[model samples]
Target: MRLDDLPLPDTPAARAALEVARRFHSPAFVNHGVRSYLWAAAAARSEGLAVDDELLFVSAALHDLGLEPAFDSHTLPFEEAGGLVAWVFAAGAGWTEERRDRAAAIIVAHMADAVDPAVDAEGYLLEIATALDISGRNPEAWDAEFRAEVLEAYPRLDLVGEFTGCIVDQAERKPGSTAAAAVAAGLPARLAANPLQL
Candidate 1:
């Protein structure tokens, strides 16, 4: 789906985020990211959670908007920039302190090697989100074993699995304006090209 069609805030944070996306980014990341949000929305509804589709969508939008100038070149990740975008969103969108804190916590824990006890934070949500987006055909494929391993740590495996499969299936079919149809179209093949193994 087009970014415009996403439910994210149409405020400064959203505008600033689009400006950043225009600089340098991956179409695969964007497409799958949207696809992921769709699944997450489903999962949220299944839980009777009132996740702001727009808020979650905005969070997903800026999930990795901080890539290097070369788009995928740098290793450090635009961490500070990611925070800035989140800050902008919290302020511009008038989010509650709990919500802002949740986003900040999630972003901070996202890249950590170990899951913390304090939260069912962003890292966990993002894993579910990103997995829903890109866990293409053969999720049983060895290449994605690490993700499977990680999912094992979640309290909602069966639920995540349900929507994740849907994400892969949807990604395979072409329906609307994706970031680059060809990119996600090639994902299953690329994922199938190699299996993950520990």
Candidate 2:
């Protein structure tokens, strides 16, 4: 699906989340967030999995929010910090406690290497979308034309380099954090394996 054709939530919560993300994140990061949601939706359709668009959009939009200097935590991993910020935003947007908690789960789970659809469809979709965007993993799931359309709409802005740098910084600053673990686990090799050339 083209970026414009993807199913995006038009609810107040979604709009507020988008606005906040745009205001706080850099243009490249915001673009990446938008593409992540679109890709997640496309992946959900391809897999015949049901997803909550609002929850998924919110999760995807704010998944990397902790990378923003303002929200960066001294100890928490970016994923956890981002999830906390998202939970607060969701609650303020009048989401039920249950919904807000679920959103937090979705945001945090996106960092996992694998997500079980049976556990949380939104999280699973976000994982697939994020992996696709960051590393170009699972390229075959999306047709070349569709991928090109998404890239045209939201350019990469050298996201691989930018994101990797962010993780490297986090690793250096927070030795026991998830980013540090990712670095220790050979993040460079993973990025080399999945190149986003579109």
TM-score of each: 0.47, 0.93
List per-prediction Cα lDDT, in the order shown. Answer: 0.46, 0.86
Q: Any residue pairs clashing in model 1, and if so which?
A: 106-122, 142-196, 143-195, 143-196
Write model 2 residue lDDT over 1-198, tens digit each, in one string: 666678579999888889998999878888889989988999888889998888899998889989889999988998999999999998899889999899889988988889899989999999888888776678888978988888888887767677888989999999988789878988756765665643
Candidate 2 local distance difference test against the native: 0.86
Task: Kindly give the stretch of ten consecutive residues in candidate 1 with the minimal lDDT sum.
Answer: 151-160
Model 2, residue 91: C-alpha shift (Å):
0.9
Candidate 2 is scored at a TM of 0.93
**How well does model 1 score by local distance difference test?**
0.46
Return the top candidate by TM-score.
Answer: 2
Using lDDT as the measure, which candidate wins? 2
Task: Give the Å shift of residue 68 in candidate 1.
Answer: 3.3
